[model samples]
Target: MTATALPRLCVVIPCFNEAANVAPMVARLDATLAGIAWEAIFVDDDSPDGTSVAVRAIAVQDSRIRCLKRIGRRGLASACIEGMLATSAPYLAVIDGDLQHDETLLPRMLEALEGGLAEIVIGSRNIEGGDKQGGLTAARQMISDTGAALANAALPMRVSDPMSGFFALPRDLLEEIAPRLTGTGFKILLDILLSAKRPLRSLEIPYSFRARVAGESKLDAAVLLEFAGLLADKALGGVVPLRFLSFAAVGAIGLLVHLAVLGLLHGLGGVGFNAAQWSATLIAMTVNFLLNNRITYRDRRLRGPALLRGLVLFYLVCGLGAAANIGIANLLLRDGVLAWGLAGAAGAALTVVWNYAVSATLVWRAK
Candidate 1:
């Protein structure tokens, strides 16, 4: 009896200073993926230790194993990119050298992809029957959870676990997104989501996050900062644009800026009311402009003469916006502070829409 043909699978492991864990992790993966038409490519990021040497030794015995030694110290993201480019398989998988990501989930992940249940199958700790290792401290878990939440808040699609580095994706999709993949390390999931032309189905497989059998974990403060920056970038990409209530929050800040300027000019500066009004309004306008530019209209581009034109139009729109805000605020203020706040918020939201259109068409002009 002849054995049935298996699907072609390429497991790309990104290794950085993981000599101790790399060999064992490679062996485990080889054993795990034995049934499939699998090739394990270990892309080493110039580890000081002899990780490449060990992988090379193993590759001599096993035709399925190959090692890529980048003499220049490349990062995890780049290593993955290099491995993906080198492999010749329709289905590709990414895993960490740390061994925190389970190799046991590889078959099931491939199964999910083969069944057409998901274009990308993630081995998720958040899923049922999945567990994190001892290294995952309370603070670390919270930080990870918060990051995932923020990412979901910005993206249109919600994956139960977006932070998982261990995932399988089709080579075609990877090639499509390869051009736009940001330097934001480790969060390739976001890169895929933002760049993929087709909708992605996801599978949350159960697996335990294991301890590194040999080397230390590489996560650091700098990596966390990079992650936070990625989250901020995602937010600025019109993901959830602070929502309707966020406009009100900006208005409230604007009010504080306005009142503070007004009081300084009138009470202490002793400037006349009309002159003070213009001064205070101008200061408030600057504050609002900065806030909206940073938060509400962040994704919109601004350049050239169009930026100046947009600024002029934004202020003009603000005057109409202010009148509407005041009218609604007054009517709602008669009822309550919350109502007045809501009404002012509504007005500010309308103005943001006005700002978005003019900015998109004229200033930044991002299609």
Candidate 2:
């Protein structure tokens, strides 16, 4: 296609470990979008299975197909943003690289954009003709249903399926709302809709969700946690980043762990109070680091040597935080602004805030 001959549709397929499905996905799109000019962008997260390598090989043969290999960062929403920004196509859309969504609906979805019938056309699996039984396992269907409920609760206009990984809309509108999008997790469709300046004129076309032909389904308990973080982000008007919220939530869990460990050691094990407190804090800090690394800094998760380095650094950070907590509490008490209990509470909150801020910037610094 010439520079002026940009395709009418740019399909962004955010993927991870989708090496086997890349070529088949393109062939399906080629058949589905027969008369329409379109391009498929496979945004890969540098999967260990060489997903980008497979996409790159195909891209060289077909100009309409392209690949964006992201390094370091690994969120689906961020990958979608990268793919959308790289293309010049007027009508932008997204689909799972796995053969789950009905690619045939893509034509009608674009039709809505071409005819100005709607600002967005989602390939929905919850409409009249569509249902979860088509391909979903009972557990997956339950997860999808629960996710939809959580997503619709925060959406400006209710949608039959807000957790859908497949959808399409205008590039201009996407660009307009891109900056406001958290771009953190698997719910890019929901993010785009929720971030819109005005309620979008949207329509959903019924389509049967298909079973995955290749690769593993990316959904899990972690995804639901991330979805909850997105809801919290929107509920707070984006005042706090989703990862920070995740960090804080994990910290709360750590607090409970600390108390439990302290109780077990001091009461049952007959350990000295100071010794039990120190041991409990250390264990809690380790738990906090692991949870934060897994959920809060998932895209920046460390491995092997990096993991070892991170753990050591985390210990130092928490140690400094503990010292700061004690110092601040003593200062608050001496200043006579707060009683011992109130001062300690403020200091503990300070420690949590300091650890969270420092951990993200220092322990798991993302580029």
Looking at model 1, the pairs that clash are 301-364, 302-364
- Model 2 per-residue lDDT tens digits across residues 1-367: 5455779999999889989988898889999999988998899888998999999998999989898887877888889888998898999989988888888899889988889999988888898998668778888788889988877777778789888878888999888899999888888888888889577888998889887778897676788888888888888999977777788899899999999999999999999999999999899988988888888888788889999899999999989998999999999999999999999999989998898889888999977
How badly does each model clash, as a count of residue pairs? Answer: 2, 0
**Worst-scoring 10-residue span by lDDT in model 2:** 1-10
The C-alpha lDDT values of all candidates are 0.72, 0.88
Error of 1 at 48 (Å): 0.3
Instruction: Please provide, for model 1 over 214-296, each residue's C-alpha lDDT reduced to its tens digit, 9 standing for 90 to 100.
Output: 78766644455556656555546535433233444566788899999989998789999899999898888777766655554
Q: Estimate each model's TM-score.
A: 0.61, 0.95
Cα lDDT for residue 72, candidate 1: 45
